[model samples]
Target chain A: MKIIYTSFIGFVFLIVCSSIIISDLKGPESLILGSWDEVSWEYERVNSTENSNLPLDNLVKKEICSNMFIHEAETWVFKKNNRLQLVKRGHEEEELIYNLRGRGNILEMIHKDNGTEIYQIQDLTKNKLVLHFNFDLQVKGIVKMTFSKVD
Target chain B: MLRKFNNYRTHQDNLKIAILTACSAGMVNVLSVILFFAFTSNVTGHYAILAQEVAKGNWYQAAIVFIWISLFLIGNFTSNMLIIHSKPGKSTYLAHATPLILEIICLLTVSIYLQRFYLNTLWETEFLVALMLFAMGLQNGLTASITNFSIKTTHLTGLTTDLGLLFSMFTKKKYRKDKKLRRKAQILLSVVTAYMFGGISAGILHIKVGYAAFYIVCVLLGIILFYDYSVLKIKRRKRSLFTRKNILFSKKTL
Candidate 1:
């Protein structure tokens, strides 16, 4: 009877723990699933010491983002198994492995060719995701990518 | 450093231990930051982050931070507990060394796991942070408790404030002339310098050898253990030899 009571308590504890973990209240990681449409690509200055901040445009993003996996992506689909699919404008898809660090603030995406890129999740909400990254091209500043979740 | 306790510890003993342990703390902190993007040495920032996460409704992240803080507290608790309890063997040095051994084990686990089995998941990173924090807590507890709270090597926020206060006191002639005050200033300065030196070295070493930098931390900790052990052994031998001579002299007189 004592062993049965202990087993019952353990089973209840496990159920409660998993429920809290799987729920969206866990953190930004849960709220970041499904598809997100690319809203805009913006730029911000890193520090006062850095040189004049050149504004980021479509052409500038095209030239500077060769190494960044999200450069040409239109929509990002975060799958269940640490897999991320980047859908390009013409409907081309690129698959990459993604992981979050620093309480889901840092987003690391690893390309199939083994190239990697890191971005800071500046903001994550129920319907919005903002990513911040840096570029050292002719214009040196942080690039901010905003995304709106797709239904 | 490990041999003496409380008021019996000389300034040299405190300074040496502070410098060595602070350097190790600085190195461990930088390595954790570079690898996990988290601070492992101190809990001030973690407390704030915990509150922020909770306020932001990020339960998972908040829970991880809370666990890290709890591990740090538990580590400190474990170290002091070992110190007070291990004296049953009547080995003061061994009692103190016990905490260092536990710290070494904690760091070694992280090092081995990172080298062999780390999958770069969030869980893996959080677990590594927890281990490093516990190790740091063990070190900090050992130093602070043995010194009667004079030397805390794990974090510099309090030390920096103490340094500022010491500098302010040094403006007066009496404070400047006081040997105790002078010794305190010297020790604080040395800790800051050693910590900065260790931090910079870890930065460069990380760039050169990556996560292998943790081995260097393990080596530094080993030196602390070895230094105390060697000193205690020599003292024991000298006491035994002096006792033997006394016995022989008494026999001759008889």
Candidate 2:
């Protein structure tokens, strides 16, 4: 009787671990490739006191601090072969090559001139994507960018 | 249980550590998967991912994976080095407890950082992941060294392989009847079962509590450390009492 109960539990556990592995194996590329509208963006300072004096801080304050870059009809298109298309409201579309790398939740994107952008993929679902990236200010800080899929 | 080291450890001691450490490893690994989408307790999957990156000419990704694997190795090295270099005539429990204390500190740091200021940025996530991998390395090292490599709790690949070999051998009456082999089988079963239970529990808890689930793992390690410390204290008290009685008897004889 004890052996039966124990085996039953083990069998159930095997199923759970197997399911996680299968889900992970599905890959994040498909989930990230579609068009997404930028919903919101914010920066988090790691050392707010020390980095408040940096030039990037002033630039971010003037541009992205109070006013979000939520242009009407803005869409980001991630394509195959490491290509990215950024379309802003009433502006010419910019095409850039990008490489999406890393496994699991830690993802890194390398752009042609932007060097390497590291992002923590907080959540990636069928319709929602949340990303976190950091800037190396004098004291280091992060930016949280959220996007919703555009149909 | 606390004083015994290396060859002097009994089957019961091995079993106790196996169950406790495996459950802890399971919880840590599962929580990491849910929170960071990575495996911090083991490097088996990372090695495969590293190879895949290398094959695709993704040097940056490959380098990250390589560094992660190296951290796990360093963790193991640190734990064993502590165990190997204790001053003679000192309580070995201190040496054994040192690695676990370090593990607790690592987990505690991770828990506090995530709770207060986790921005979910890549560097922050990677930093947390590295700390977790190192903590697990320390744990894996301590358990493996103390048990004479008879038990490893951090990864299931080797455990599953050993289980397969044991079950196949058990089909024969000769292998099943051997006391040592049977004991080994029992130990393996306990470790594997406890590990599964831990993972299942973490899966449920992480959903409800989010990153706070890591604190529970810290508490679990604390329990193990406290248990060992209590046992050491009792052992010391008994030794002192025995010495006092011996001294009184010798004076009377004089």
Best by DockQ: 1
lDDT of each: 0.83, 0.75
Per-candidate count of clashing residue pairs (backbone under 3 Å) = 0, 0
DockQ, prediction 2: 0.05
Give the TM-score of each candidate: 0.83, 0.66
Give the runs in model 1 whose Cα sits over 4 Å from its true position. A1-33, A43-70, A79-83, A90-95, A111-116, A134-142, B86-89
Worst 10 residues of 1 chain B by lDDT: B82-91
> How many pairs in model 1 have backbone atoms within 3 A of each other, for residues 3 or more apart or on separate chains, i.e. clashes?
0
Q: Candidate 2 residues A1-151, lDDT tens each?
A: 9999997687556445544543454345666787888776655544677653233444564565345322223687777655767788746366665443334445555445665545666567778887665332122235666789988
Model 2 Cα displacement at A32 (Å)? 10
lDDT of 2 by residue, B57-137 (tens): 544445556667777987998999998898878878888889998999999899899899975444466668889899999
State which candidate has the highest TM-score: 1
